[model samples]
Target: MNNSIDTKRIVLAALFTAASFALSFIQIPIFPAAPWLMYDPSGIVCLLAALAFGPKLGAAVAILSWLPRVFLDPFGAPMGMLSTCCLIIPTAIIYAKSGNTRAGSIAGMVFGAALSIVAACALNLVVTPLYTAVTMEQVAGMILPILLPFNTLKMVINVVAGQVLLAPCMNVLHSSKA
Candidate 1:
């Protein structure tokens, strides 16, 4: 019985990860000024998995979801995957610790969104210069105008989408368990 349960969890995680992987392709530009900064629903998928399963499995989903991108888009994959992990881990941890309730999901997503904004700013300040000709100063200048609002909007979309899907996802998980 334990083995079966574990198998089900693994299968569920894999399925969520696969869905996230596919969702990564459906990117939309959130900021008109920064068209290169695209938003995807992959992170929301990871959050849903986290709420249904546990943080560990959610983290697994986040990492596995980015595997394809690592090979397909060598230039942006690393930073994108890192940023995604940064976003999902905090959300999962908060949700898991808060008892994984609907309220906890909302709280977790809010916290995670805030964290993502800061992390994006810091990462862009440090890493963006290494990849592009832009310096830290230039990136810093765009933080308030571009990165902040962009990340916030992206996270809002993720949080709202995750909340909207949470019921159906939980229903599926519960039914599967039975």
Candidate 2:
């Protein structure tokens, strides 16, 4: 029985991780000011994985999902992976702690979104200067104007999409267990 459950978890994780990686390729540039800072729906899959399984699994999926991008964009990919984990882990943890209620999901999503934005901003301040020609001051300047809005939008999209699909996904998973 334990082995069966483990196998199911492994299969689910693999599927979610693959879905996230594939979704990462579909980037939508919402903010004109920072076209390079595109939003990918990969985080939604990570959020779903986290909410379904656990934070550790969610974080694992988040990191694995961005691994391909690491080869493609070494410096930028790490930032994306970090920011994604920031969003997934918190949401999973908070939701689990809050008894898995709808309110808990809301709280978790809001908290996770805020944290992801803040972490992305801080990472930009430190790492953006290293890869890009942008200085820390310039990055700081763009925080309020560009980074904040872009990250916020990204999180909002992820949260909304995750919420919409979550109940159905959960139902399917539960039924499968039976």
lDDT against the true structure, per candidate, is 0.81, 0.91
Model 1 TM-score relative to the real fold:
0.90
| Candidate 2 structure quality by residue, lDDT tens digits, 14-132 | 99999999999998999898898888899999999999998998999999989989999888889999999999898999999998888998899999999999999999999989988
Residue 32 of model 2 has an lDDT of: 93
Tell me each candidate's TM-score.
Answer: 0.90, 0.95
lDDT tens digits by residue: candidate 1, 1-178: 2424576777878899999999999989878999999988888898888777666677788888988898887656666666666667777787778777778778888887787778777888988888799999999999999989998888888889988999898887787665
Candidate 1 C-alpha RMSD relative to the actual structure: 2.1
Error of 2 at 88 (Å): 1.0
> Candidate 1: where are CA atoms >4 Å away?
1-5
Report RMSD for candidate 2. 1.7
**Cα lDDT, model 2, residue 56:** 90
